[model samples]
Target: MSVLDQKQTHKYSMKPESAPVFKNLSSDLPSGLVVFLVALPLCLGISLASGAPLLAGIIAGVVGGLVVSVLSGSQLSVSGPAAGLTVIVLNGIAKVETFQAFQLAVVLAGILQLVLGFLKAGIIGHYFPSGVIKGMLAAIGLTLILKQIPHFLGADKDFFGEMEFFQFDGRNTFSEMAYAFQHIEKGALIIGVLSLLLIMGWDNPRLKRFAFFKFVPSALIAVLVALGLNYFFKLNLPALTVGQEHLVQLPQMDTWQKLVNQLSLPDWRALQNPDVYILAVTIAIIASLETLLSVEAVDRIDPLKRVTPTNRELKAQGVGNFISGMLGGLPMTAVIVRSSANINAGGKTKASAFTHGVLLLFSVLFLSPFLNQIPLSALAAILLVVGFKLTKPSLYLNQFKLGWEQFIPFFVTVVAILFTDLLVGISIGLAIGVFFILKANYKTPYFFHTEKHKQGEVIRLQLSENVTFLNKASILLTLHHLPDNTEVIVDGSKSTFIDYDVLDAIQSFKVNAKERNIRVHLQDIPEVISTNAH
Candidate 1:
């Protein structure tokens, strides 16, 4: 092996994963800050998209970070309100008639997830094809880039966290861009461009050589810089002043008594309605799938290469969602965007995730006024950077070079997700993948070989070790094509098991062969006699 390769392998093998979670406070602190900055806007925006109270999203974030992180087996995964669940949450609320009623569904969903975890249903996530998973990641990245463009351009018509192709405002993905171009705000535009540049520069290896810049969280720096710029422009550069609409809109809670009034209770009466149960099942399935997928993705990026227990993660999510629901929060799941930000900022343990949640809670309680000053454009710029990294040209090329069998499903997944919702897109990719698998197995289910004998041609049909119903059609076709008056020996000595349908077909063919004057001999293959004659 090359020296560099050996060195890298050694370094990776030496990672101290057994250390206490709080051991790396320096790394966790900065990482928690980055995650907090990324998560704050997403929590608010997802609530806006779901037609739920804005505070509900924040409660989910707090529960996800504080509660889920504590119970979860994953060290690096961060959880919160997910863009993938936005449509479902909206439709569920509409069906249940009230936001409080939807909370009941969320609570039931948590119970369902807990049951699933105990049943060990998390193994389903591991079965996802590698190509499809990569496709999912790429799709999310591209979607983020496309959705964030309007925010980056200072167009505040559509809110943040709209990752789907179709928006709530009657416009599709492309139309949002067209709208942004026409109504772009100059001040927001300037800050977006500069923030993008700074974020990109921070990631560059050449610029990161400076030790001073290495310790600072790039996304946090970007937000603070953008906030300062907007404030400065309003005082001095009048033409470049950004309007309040283009900035974040955290709810203003000025006093402690007001915070208590904001707390909401779930409608237990909704559970008596049957529709709530259906919604509960739907939420449980989708949330578990998203969590498993995120767990898989986060493991792929971990520096220490620690494996997470999927069942434990589901249990953790179940607990968090239950608490959040009881407290009037939206459904929660392990979100990819904030998790990626946490990893990129050098998070070492679950402490970073939990700390980020604490920061989120503290920020809303005490720093809402300051957070409101942060521009949406700056946050968009940070998301754009993450989006670009995920959908890099290298990722596309790698998938393409894996051949059409892999590429077709992978490419199909990306296109479907762009046009449809997350679950629908993933289902399409899985269907195409299964088609390829069945096609390969349909043709070669038996070993057929012929040799010339002294009297006549001797044919041997050797059944595979575990031939089943899938091989029935191929065996029937081969037997029918055989020349009349030929000597044939059907062998199944090596087979551990054979389907009854295949055995019956061979036995029926033997009777037909006798009339044609063909010599048919059966070896260890089973014979079936019909009992339906009674």
Candidate 2:
């Protein structure tokens, strides 16, 4: 199918009115399992990237699924240690001497988010331009694909979730790809190729209709198949065998005492250090932006067309992050990948989200042994697909067709992220977007569309709905350059608030009209007493 057709299909699936069985446990259970399967690899990979303890990602996943889901107003969106914040987390960790101190930062960030939620800062999410948001989404998608390539090839030194141009090693993104080719392990390459092929086949339209396939996530099936192959055939084809180094590794803890010993402790002393507060504010703002964006995307795919309460979602995320940090988890956000999987899997309600969390908790507590055997190559393959879905060509084409006003910022963001980090790229995109906003405003404070009348030329100046001091230059420029003996009508009928600067300019021009032979008429405009009147 064409991209347009695929988009239409998604839109059709999301019309919430069509699906009335939101409480169907049968559907939600299976769907939640699928989301859990997807979240596992992502959580681990992101934690790896953040330089946090391996268990920290799992902690974020559990809290996201269990704590945040319950508190969130979003019935469908899922939360976890997102790739978008991986770089920020790593940088924050660097700023503080220990991971424990970073956890303290996460706690502070959560508190900030709570304050923002109460302040109703969620409305600000709506103010972000659509072009910038799409740019961000696309940039993240491309970053995922680029960062996962080395992992897929079993070059596991670099973090699978790193979005920056530079790697943990000194190499940049393309340089890492070159190194991966030179150091490719035969066994890993075979597994990666096969697993990727499996993903492609699983995406086939004809095969998904089977009842069994309908219940099982394609990613889970592919991972299981890869694991079975590695476990059974590792001895025979050494070249194709996935080593323990290339498989999932979880710390073995048989009892509650052992697990408690493994958990890291946050340094309360770090709270008194003012530097921690700076990191806290940064994490809170960036994490909130990422979460709000994911919520926006997930709401689009929601079967019920339900609108998520952004403020409530922020509060829920705040609570979750605070708890996660207390327990030594990395920062968290509403991640679009797992959320999309949940929606696509026919997840019915928040139960699917809650269930996914329970499943993560269960896996860490009881099933880590089995999970540790899954090859990293398999997860990398799955992420490759997830990445492709986000930066699809169709999304680019759609934006390009919208004109340069949208496409320029979108393309710039993608390029910026490719060369820099997520936060930096997004900042560049926002800066460019703001420039466009100002550019439009520079021309729009007042209407300058002139018309010819029987008596020479007539100029009608209609002030915009909200004219601020920014409009002063344009208004004055028009007034100062008016032709002699021209009739000018200044209309403020549609404006609710006109700045004093603008009113003063108009009143000054009215007084100067006597010398210039200009005829001036004001409509619903307030007069400013000008010194020129004296």
Candidate 3:
């Protein structure tokens, strides 16, 4: 069947069904495996960054994959714990004073998300201007570049902290670069460079054409190589080796079992804490925004050009987040990293996403030791690539082509994100975007008329659709251009709505018409207003 036919069929079909056979299972499975590899490290890293238990991230990923896949309308999009939420999670943990308490807040956040979905707030995502969305993506790209540099350099102290243009470490990304230079770990630096090279080699056409290497993802290869070098060569690499300090070290089994056993209900005692409510609201908003943005982005890249049901997606995410939170997991959303990987891997249906969750669950249960062997630097190298893809030089060129309206917001968002946190940076960019939109609307011509008119000539001034106070200046300008004793007809039959300010402007113009020896006529105005006016 044709693509359109398939889409129509999918849209109209009521019950859930399996994906077609002959779909490339090999590609999807391998892609899922690669994503799993990439996601495992990110889950641990983001969880650590968020001050949450490492397992929480893993649990979020599994739930996102398993539960969300079945519930979501998106076919190829992958859901999981996101690095984007690290700042919010960190702040929430600090406020609650206990992980369990923070988790309670997460559950409440999920409930809020469900309410948002019920309210059909997902449609809000559709209203964001194309320019603004592009700007947001570009800004996120720039953030990746700034945030990943420290990790790439084996400087783990900052751990994805926002770096501003003027500061580094506590200052900005540039300052962090300076700090890294002063205290560079030679061992870490060497491994980082080597890992970068190995990752870069993965895309080489010659390597890709080789059958043996085709099945192995570059990230997996890089990690294996790093592990081998670390173990056999006795390389005294400082940050090169994934040390117990840097690696995800699960709590001791006894302690872990104790914590799990002691899982307490949401402290009803703290229900009155305004901070908890604030956090719950924040999580819902941020998670929803992120999910909507990811859905849009993934659809853009989807080979099938499938459009997901936004409301359904929100509901699915809400359900997943609620369940994940109840199970002591971090906040979950449709993350771009795994979604992109799924697309690249040729996922044809939601099954691939669901399968990925299953894999994650099994891996955690059975392959914890094997996972620990994967070098942190190797994963960092993968993120380095992901970060580069986000902030590519081509992105800048594309935005530049879109002109200043788009370029300004995109550049501002990037710079702001580099200096401040993601949410703050995006808020500033959005505010600026709104300003530009209003300014553009204000510049639109209010009145269209000829340059000159003979005395007593009948001239018609055409107003565009939806006349408002913003058009007053142009209307006045046109009227002032008319010759003395001209007969003017104000035409607004096409306009569906007229602002009170515009009506007042017209009334004022009418009162002054006799002074200029002009005779004015109105067209297509409501009879009630036209008859009442002199």
Candidate 4:
């Protein structure tokens, strides 16, 4: 089928009844397994960055996968605790003191999300300009590039937690790169380079066709290879070493009973702190925005071209977040990485997401020791690829072609995100984008399509639909430029709605007609208004 045909087929074929039950279930199970692998380290890493208990991340992943998958309206979208929210959560934890208090704020945030979903606030996502969304993706991509450099170079002193343009360490992403060259760890760099090469080689067309490697994920292969190299070559290269400090160090649980004992509850005392309220509100807004953005991104990539119910997504996410918080977990949202992995793994339903959660639970319970052995640098390599994908040069080129209106906002958003934090950068970019749109509309002629009549040189100027105060300047300019001794006919036939200010402007133009030796005429106007002359 042609691309257009495929798109239409995908779009029209998306009915719940039409979904292949058995086939989807089978495909999703394995797909979920893949997503589980991708999500595991990320969940732990993000949780650590957020200053929350490592178990909290696993709990959020499980809840997000299991609970949110069942409740969400999206078929292939995956939900989990996001690195995007780590900074916010970290700050929230610092302000709220005890982790229990932070849990209360998370619960409140969940409640707020639930309310937003019920109120159909997800519609807000629909209104975001396509340009701005593209820009956001680009900015996120740039951030990934900047932040991953230190990891690639084995520089851990500058914490991975920082996403701002300028760091507290008095360096930006670029400056860090400059510093990294001089103080590069040979072991980490070699391993990172080898991991990257292996990943790139796995994607080579000829190699991908090989039966043995075809089904294996490049990330898994890279990790295994790195581990083998670490063991065999005994490369004591400092840069190559996946530092113990950088790895996922799960809290030592002596037994299954001890693990269960680590579970926590929200502190009611946190509710008393005003900072908790602030943090809750911030979480609600940022989480909502991130979810909305991810939904959009996922939809773009979906082969089925299915449109997800945004409100239902919000409600599902709320429930997930609430449950996660109650169980001592970080905040959760529908993330693009695992979602894309699900699709790439041929996931066709929510079962994939649920299965991923199940797999995560199993890994945590049974494979904790093995998981801990996987180097942090190896996982960092995975994220490094993710980051590169987000900020690729192709994305920048694509945004530029979308026109200046889109490009400017997108560039600004990227720059803002690079310099500031995610929320602040997105806000600034969104504000600027909205302003440009309004300004563009303001410059458009309020009245269009003029025709001159021979009898009295009567010029009929037709007003377009939805005229507002912003069009006043255009209208006035047109009127003021009209030659003297001309008969002016104001036509409102096409105008469905006109603001009072526009009507006032028209009335003023009529009053001033005699002074310019112009005769005014009105056509297709409402009888009630036409009869009551100003």
Candidate 3 lDDT score relative to the true structure: 0.71
Per-prediction tally of clashes: 0, 3, 7, 10
The 10-residue segment of model 1 with minimum total lDDT is 525-534
TM-score of each model, in listed order: 0.87, 0.86, 0.83, 0.85
lDDT of each: 0.83, 0.79, 0.71, 0.76
lDDT of 2 at 106: 93
Local error of candidate 2 at residue 40 (angstroms): 2.5
lDDT of 4 by residue, 70-101 (tens): 88877788999887788888888999888999
Model 4 clash pairs are 141-390, 141-391, 165-418, 165-419, 185-239, 186-239, 187-239, 187-240, 188-239, 188-240
Clashing pairs in 3: 163-418, 164-419, 167-171, 167-172, 168-171, 168-172, 168-176
Cα deviation of 290, candidate 1, in Å:
2.0
User: Local error of candidate 2 at 201, Å?
Assistant: 2.8
Q: Pick the candidate with the highest lDDT.
A: 1
TM-score of 3: 0.83
Task: List the candidate 1 regions with Cα displacement exceeding 4 Å.
Answer: 1-20, 254-257, 303-305, 444-534
Per-residue lDDT of candidate 2, residues 318-343 (tens digit): 99989999999999999877887787
Q: How should the candidates be ordered by TM-score, best one leading?
A: 1, 2, 4, 3
| Cα shift from native, residue 135, model 4 (Å) | 1.5
**After best superposition, candidate 3 residue 23: deviation in angstroms?**
1.8
Give stretches of model 4 more than 4 Å off.
1-34, 158-162, 168-170, 207-212, 233-240, 252-256, 269-275, 337-349, 451-456, 468-473, 499-501, 504-522, 525-534
